[model samples]
Target: MSKTGKSKHRFPEFTDADAWEQRRLGEVAEFAKGRGYSKKDICSEGTPIILYGRLYTNYETVINDVDTYTELQENSVLSSGDEVIVPSSGESAEDISRAAFVQNSGVILGGDLNIIKPNETIQSTFLAITLSNGSQQKELSKRAQGKSVVHLHNSDLKVVNLSFPTLPEQERIGAFFQTLDATIASHQRKHSQRRV
Candidate 1:
């Protein structure tokens, strides 16, 4: 037991199984795959966009352009505060577990990415942080399977275990992390300016 009266890595301090709730990813949110867009479809102006290829280890939403699409590409819709994860990639299996929080609106994800939209019960930031943690990353790496190219599916993420507290607690945790992220962003901006 640690100072928090729980294991050094454990969280929320649950007393028993009844104290914690188990829910599928679908139960708390909707998981959808991204659209497959051709190279010609990408434009210099229009709707915001996000491609799994651009997702980094950090949860930064890297936009290549302001292109938009007229037709509704399958599984391309994404709202703000959604969790975007790359389950399939050309990189190593361990690298495909990268996930990010969508802080921008009207952004469409490209194929190779899975978008998870929480159903109001969970905080998007909290979910992103939880998934990015070392423990969860290890679990995700274990579940990822593929011979040539590693891949993960919606069902795989749905069954993954998650720990949570009450809604209020979730909000507090999310806010605390958000502040930390902001601080990091500020420092990054300062460093970039120094390089210029």
Candidate 2:
């Protein structure tokens, strides 16, 4: 394991920085099971939608581009732009616990999503990255059932350990990854266009 409990790379400047604080997901964030949307509830054009399954398929560690929208009979499922949507169920245990940071406001938080809204001290992107990273995901995945339609409950997420550094360090990590994600997205767009 690397310093700060990371299993991989660390910022050069923060190599000697303080060790990251370790805490359970429940201790740092509020979690809620998202509202389930029926097949009838989903639409091609309407309020932007984020189906929990999309966290694994469409997004990387963070989601800025919302491609699908649906009309909800009730509009209670909306993001304030900081919710981290996690898959509550998947085809395999390894597929569970995948997450995406939602920064776009007004997007609907669909069902089968374990939505994590981190408290004021935690950066949403950093939390998203930490969860996206292999370590935390491994811990969470272990709790997921591997049988058909594997599921991870809100209770399961509440106990997953998350390691994080100081506020400033978290900011740096989040900013760095955000920029990296943007660069990757830009390149992907170009690559797709080239093939067209």
Error of 2 at 84 (Å): 0.9
What's the lDDT for all of these models?
0.64, 0.81
Q: All candidates' TM-scores?
A: 0.73, 0.87
lDDT for residue 183 in candidate 1, whole number 0-100: 88
Q: For residues 93-178, could you state the per-residue lDDT of candidate 2 as single tens digits? A: 77886778898888888888889999987889889888877688898778898577888888888898888887878888989988
Number of the top-ranking candidate, with lDDT as the measure: 2
Give per-residue CA lDDT, model 1, range 1-196, as digits (tens): 0111222432453333323344655678788787776446666665666656556533442222333444446665565645545545646667777677776676767677777887777777767777767666677777788878887777778776666555666676667777887788789989999999
Residue-pair clashes per prediction, in order, are 1, 0
As a TM-score, model 1 comes out at 0.73
